[model samples]
Target chain A: MDIIVCVKQVPDTTDVKIDPKTGTLIREGVPSIVNPDDKHAIEEALRLKEKHGGKVTVLSMGPPQAGDALREASAMGADDMILLCDRAFAGADTWATSYTLGEAAKKIGYDLIICGREAIDGDTAQIGPQMAEHLELPQITYVRKVDVDNGKIICERALEDGYERVEANLPALLTVISDVNKPRYPSVRGIVEAYQEKEITTWTAADIQADEKCIGLDGSPTSVKKSFAPEPKGEGEILEGTTNEVCKQLVAKLMDKNVVR
Target chain B: MEFALNKEQEMIRKTAREFAENEIGPIAAEIDETTEFPKDTVKKLGELGFMGMTVPKEYGGAGMDDVSYAIAVEEISRVCASHGVTMSVNNSLVCWPLQKYGTEEQKQKYLIPLANGEKLGCFGLTEPNAGTDAGSQTTVARKEGDKYIINGSKVFITNASQSQTAIIFAMTDKSKGTRGISTFVVDTDTPGFSIGTIEQKMGIRGSVQAELVFENMEIPQENLLGKEGRGFGLAMATLDGGRIGIASQALGIAQAAYEESVKYAKEREQFGKPIAKFQAIQWFIADMATEIDAARLMVYKAAFDKWQGKPYTVSAAMAKFFASDIAMNATRNAIQIHGGYGYTKEYPVERFYRDAKITEIYEGTTEVQKMVIAGNLLK
Candidate 1:
């Protein structure tokens, strides 16, 4: 079996200070890391490899520095690592990112494609399905439990209420959540070996045979017209009285808001 | 014991868990197997202010309390021990010293870069002859006019090869023993300063560890840390803080191991039933969970003490010793639960077992920790 995991490098939000004057994210001192959810996707791929004995390849698209995330995936346990980086790929929304990643995945044929439910930066939860649509592959989203056997893939997906058990044939895509498995810590020897090894492969837009029209900002369908922080809720009114009076006031407020029938 | 974490601590814990699970966990084993350093990951950690968790905001650090630092270390280690150590060394050993003893200019120049992750920093004290006995180091420095010429080498220094700056300890007055020692901040770019061979380590290999050789290395007088002859105290103080970080790392490793074991036991079948249904397997999980909880409490207590500006040396030592021991035990049991598969490279528990052993040996050996705790109690 061959598994491909898509990962992304994103600026850690806590470190991302907004420039008030420009209303833009301050990228100067902020460090870009592998998007937290994407890691679950990588782990799921590794898990599939462990159970079915297959090759695990990790693919990511970002700046030249995003190669670090690929190298990191390699260090963890990825059999093959690729960085899909190019200047043309800049300023991409989720649509463009999925398109680029989908094209790259198509180039690297796989029995299964895995990704995190969403990237932390965007939180759109659109990339997995978009990539699936682009690749024209069946997709399983919000996977909590996965079982691979005899070329058949079974997954339990978290839904609004409980969970949904789904089955798909080989060559499908899976977007995972954190509860799937706890990731292993890199050992000292793993660190040393990852440092010494040169397994990360870099690819540009031309390398993946992607059309110029469907590659970056031009290819993207969605664009953020404007971004703003959520408005703060009004302060609560204080009711100073005996316990019964306070309870009555709270009940009245709840009724006024239709929270209590 | 209350299992509930406060809002802020819980938020930090959740964020760290999500980051570690998503970012570091998948690649941790590969980095360990190949000994690769995740430079980008380190930079990301710096942006999160993890590299300077305890340093004040003015110094380009996170300005977080010590408990938050411990939480961060535990969460990171839970996914990748190498990154955990790298984070620990940066936040506690390198960045902490500068924040505490550095002059305003020193803070602006060295601490800023180190804290921001633009530059990596290392702490140097151990020599070939000095591991546990760091005060017996042979590295020396001689004052000449406006500069101090340093000679000799430091061994087994974490982040030495990659660090832009190193807070190094050297003896200035040989006759005064520990009192003669002084600390200096040396730039790795100095003509006479060079990194030696990287050591082939058993675990935590993602972090750079090598010998730092200083041959007639010239440092400006302003680079001297604190007052002359205060190096011993400074080093001790630094280690006190470092112990908590190591303890947190141990807690993370233990948690990872225990969690893996639990999952495996529930899934793997033997004797017509999942091993988790067996008494023996159930007992092991119970022990692992109990010990991990205890270790977490100890580590958090030490971090809390430090955050409160109280003396935490004894608590830190105890935490380090106990947590590291628990890590080793948890990893061993996790492998045992996997049976034969656990011993192979195919299983991560074996690697966790191997990696967990070093936590007891470094950052003040478990034996040394006992001595420290006992000695402090006696005093």
Candidate 2:
């Protein structure tokens, strides 16, 4: 029942400010936080480990500062952590990121690998499925609930409308949605233990024996030419009046616009 | 030397703040109006490891340093002062002293559940006769062959009625005066122990204070805490550390009021513009901001001194006295900033006003704090 969770550290979207002139985010003052949905993935993995007797390991591929996310994961009851940080891992797209993660995953007894369905910053939703492809294991996406039995995993996956149930055998991957479980805050005791006791192992490119040609910016095929905030739109009308008057006005306006007959 | 909190401390503060805002903030006003105890929230606080933030992990506590405890208290108090006091009395006055002085057997029986927040506990020091002068005790405990009979009553005891455990002090030998006091770990369910009455308080209504009566209450000799005659020192030691918690709590109340005041002042207009345009309003806001920052620094300093094993009695007293005073002033100003609306229950400033006064009076009074500070200076 050994489980591995892949987490990422991203700029706190709430605090981010964009430079209108440069059409880029001002990263200097903004704080870095654990990717929001990734916490749910960690929670799901921990819950699974709790029910079935096993250890939970959190692995992350980012800059050295990503240790903050790994440390946070540890505080949330991760059994151990590995920070896949290296200069060579810079400028990675989702494809290269998953390949590096797959290399690290090979070293562990990964009965199940869990990840957030999508990173909010990139919103690619590709890393989970890509890692699964690299590992040659079945992968479940948008998982909201998980139930495990003897070498069998049942995942209730969320879809565009309603949801669907999917099952996979041992050595599978799951990409969880934020709706999966309410992530628990790191307990005070857990925080102290994480800081005072746990050791977070840091791995470089050579440590994981990743192929030079298939790692870092060299391997990333995707490139962004420009980024900018969309132009603001005018505030929408409230259509405020008496309930009957507002409804009548709304209907007249919609009919005038040919929206409703 | 560093003003910044460590990473772990920040994490604890963030967790407490998030819990307070998301879970406690919505119901805080309602709880104040009804004076209903938030038992479920308190239990959640315990499960979150906030009830015993500074206790060591071995004793089923958070194992955080005193500074972290201060941050936790301040953050919790910022939202609901009721929860603040409940957590404060548990961590500072009960679990702390229990960890320090309790025998291994006592720690095992009482400290485990208390530190883990599985059970709630209270300190029974203030009584009918004893308030400012804690040495004067009317409660008597006469030793029997294998047990002691406790008689008399405790008043204004936080969590008295609801707590499962209590660390009570009583006169073991009347002739020895203050030295006669002995501390005992009393289980609230023991026969002859009763909750007399719940006090109708002006503020912090969520966590009510109650009277505890001990009539012919019997307990085993093993329940004795520290030494028989050394209870005064133990009690004072506990109260000294307790000051840091209360100070932090006061800082939280003041911080909350200050924030509310700014928000109100910004949107509230009097003469064609926001009231914030007036120098009078701006000055009050400025003073509150400055005082809160100073009080916060003092609290962290006291907590840091305690963590470093320095003699922090004077600093703790200073922090308690100054912070509580600021809490009272800031809440009053918050109400003033809101004008007529502040006096009404429609806003939370009125509740903050009521909660602020208690901080200056509890744990140790402002006068008591001054005396402690003066006494230390004269020494």
Candidate 3:
């Protein structure tokens, strides 16, 4: 099966810094990493490619620097990569970003689409399902396992209370969580081959036939008004006891506070 | 003049860092405490092309440059110095010389497997009496038709018992002194070959040292490495590259120590304030960061020079000497920074402290490195 995995490069939240003056992130010195959940998505894609003998292509819509993420995907065993980079795509929120990727996807449609459940930066968890809607395909969210046999695709999706198995025809999109699988590090040979031979096809907005009205900040409906760290909550009590004792005391305290049973 | 690592080098660094963090970090302390070699992870490292990173792709290697090898060593050593040395020895000592001097058949037979990390190998140059003065080796080899009867014992050899093959150095003509030395690719399972004592070490305990005794051990003449008299020069040249690996290892240890101290000073409190606020602690941190930066530049310079086929002996020695000194200094201060916590095994810094000492002593001692540098300078 031909697979297209969408990925993004985000600033490492572990070392994030904020600009107090502008109420925005200070990204000058921050390290950029492939989105964590997207790494799992790639792992799943690679695993699928390994199993049924198919091609895996990674697609991304971001700045030119996002090619780093694409190269990383290739090193992790993607057969091809397409990077949608254009000044017209800057300052795009989820709507505009998904629209651009939707256009790119239409231009380079695949038998399957894979994405991370959510981006740590936005935490919106909307892009994957939004892109699926734009492409007019069904999506399985929070997928922990993917199985393809015959002409059908099967997924086990994680839910809050339990998990459900979902089946769909070929040409489907999946948004996976971290529980899917651990990503493998690229081998030294893989890194060398990726840089030496792989070409990261850069697609401008016009190349993907993206609508000017549906890209960049000009296309987004929502706008951020302010940004700041949330107020620090006071520390809660640390309950230390045996497992059974801790469970009894935790239940008793919750009952006393009327928080839960 | 460029300071930034290229994209490929950066990726290798990131890959090594992630692998070291995920696979080696958790078990590093446990292995050090138990003195158990992480055979599984080490073999995986080989499969990942770290064993013979500098060797060409045709030779079953990752086809990376010396610079990448240096980066890999530094990253692995950051979490586990024992794994670092194991990789360094395979890349620098065993695979390196064989690639440079071995014949086509020899390359196919030995270098391929060694580079592939399919088999472990050791360099048997340092004996009981031939530590600093390697030319004074007491081992002897007598040629008999197609075989050489070797007789001697090599002590303080790293990966001795674990290695399946060894580059054994012995005297072919005792009258020629240094020129008498001959190197052979001897299988450790040779009939008369026996593994003797295992050393109880201070640091890098996971990668143990052992003694190999050869009593009339028969090695085929085709197993000879390079020319008979040229063995010493090959060994010396191999060490020139080996020192870069050692320097990178030391840099990793120092970096680990430095990072631990910074984390400690920030969280550790005194007088109801973080200890990092104190000028004494700040000064130590500053010194450590600056020294690490300088040492890294030196190490990278040597690695680059080696890749470019330039003269890098003095630079390697300088890097090795300086980096190992900084390692000892930084680990000592890291323990000082943690006060009591760093002294205990609970913190990884104690193991880092133990691992740092070996970098100065192995490959070449600090004094040997200085002599090499001074000797080059005199010319």
User: Largest lDDT belongs to which candidate?
Assistant: 2
Each model's fraction of native contacts: 0.00, 0.88, 0.75
Which structure is stronger by DockQ: 1 or 2? 2
Selected candidate, larger DockQ, 2 vs 3: 2
Window of ten residues with lowest summed lDDT in model 2 chain B: B1-10
Best by DockQ: 2
**TM-score of the first chain alone, every candidate:** 0.87, 0.94, 0.91
How many clashes show up per model?
Answer: 31, 0, 0
Please list, in the order the candidates appear, how each scores on TM-score for chain B only.
0.98, 0.99, 0.99
RMSD per model, one decimal: 20.6, 1.6, 2.3
A1-261 per-residue lDDT for model 2 (tens digits):
999999999999889887888877798978788999899999999898889979999999987788889989999899898999899999988889999999999986689999998887888999999999999999999999999988999999998998999999989999999999999888888888888889899999999999988888998988778777877688899888899999999999999999999
Best by TM-score: 2
Per-residue alpha-carbon lDDT of candidate 1 for residues B26-137, written as tens digits (9 for 90 to 100): 8888899788778888877776667876676678775666887899899999888899999999889999889899999999999988986788889999999989998997
Error of 3 at A61 (Å): 1.0
- When summed lDDT is taken over every stretch of 10 residues in candidate 1 chain B, the lowest stretch is B3-12
Query: Model 3's CAPRI class?
Result: medium
